[model samples]
Target: KREFITDDDSSDVTGAHVSKIESTIMVKTEASSVVLTQQQTSHLNHSQQSITTQQQQQQNVHIKQQPQQHNNIVQQAHPQQ
Candidate 1:
């Protein structure tokens, strides 16, 4: 007497994997600015005046109205004794 045993099997497997990534960037800047302005104005005026004067005077006068007279007399006598 002989005995025989036989086994037959079939297997199937399916799998799926997915991955996503995101990136960000940054930038920096520095700057300086300046402005200046100036203005000036001036004015001047002058005036002057002068005056002078001088004077001189002189006078002389004379007058005469009159008359003058003069007289002289002489007498002599002699006696003998």
Candidate 2:
């Protein structure tokens, strides 16, 4: 059996003095699914330094399984310029 998965997404962040940050991640397989979520907060002395950031992520994965042979998995991610 062989499986392939790909994800491409963009995110926008809005905050003042780094009030809060949150993220979620998910992974799925034929048998089950796994998910994780995390959040963090930051306090800054100067409110004028607050700003928003935008980011984009692209990922590609390839998985292969063989009955009488070895299994193989390949994953790659694109870096921002």
Candidate 3:
């Protein structure tokens, strides 16, 4: 069997779940009737932010900090090493 999801004219929709029982495919995609709580939305936002930050950090290390002003600065900073 095959199933499809569509953007109906319903705005109060929430979760679209599908389950198989015996030889029948049950698809419940009508409406949520109840709005999602604020906690759920906040959790999603937090996860997205963390992912974005981690990606940015992995992009560059010392490429973001300022470089030495002149050769003198470099010599003064690292004399032996």
**Top model number, lDDT:** 3
As for lDDT, the candidate ahead, 1 or 2, is 2
Per-residue alpha-carbon lDDT of model 2 for 24-55, expressed as tens digits?
22212211111011111111211211231121
Ranking by TM-score: 3, 2, 1
Leading candidate by TM-score: 3
Ranking under lDDT, best-scoring first?
3, 2, 1
For model 2, the stretches where C-alpha displacement exceeds 4 angstroms are 1-23, 28-60, 65-68, 72-81
TM values, all candidates: 0.07, 0.13, 0.15
- 5-60 in candidate 3: lDDT tens per residue? 34441322532322233212211111111112222433443345435544323222
The residue ranges of model 3 lying beyond 4 angstroms of the native Cα positions read 1-38, 52-81
User: Under the 3 Å rule for N, CA and C atoms, how many clashes does model 1 have?
Assistant: 0
Cα deviation of 18, candidate 2, in Å: 16
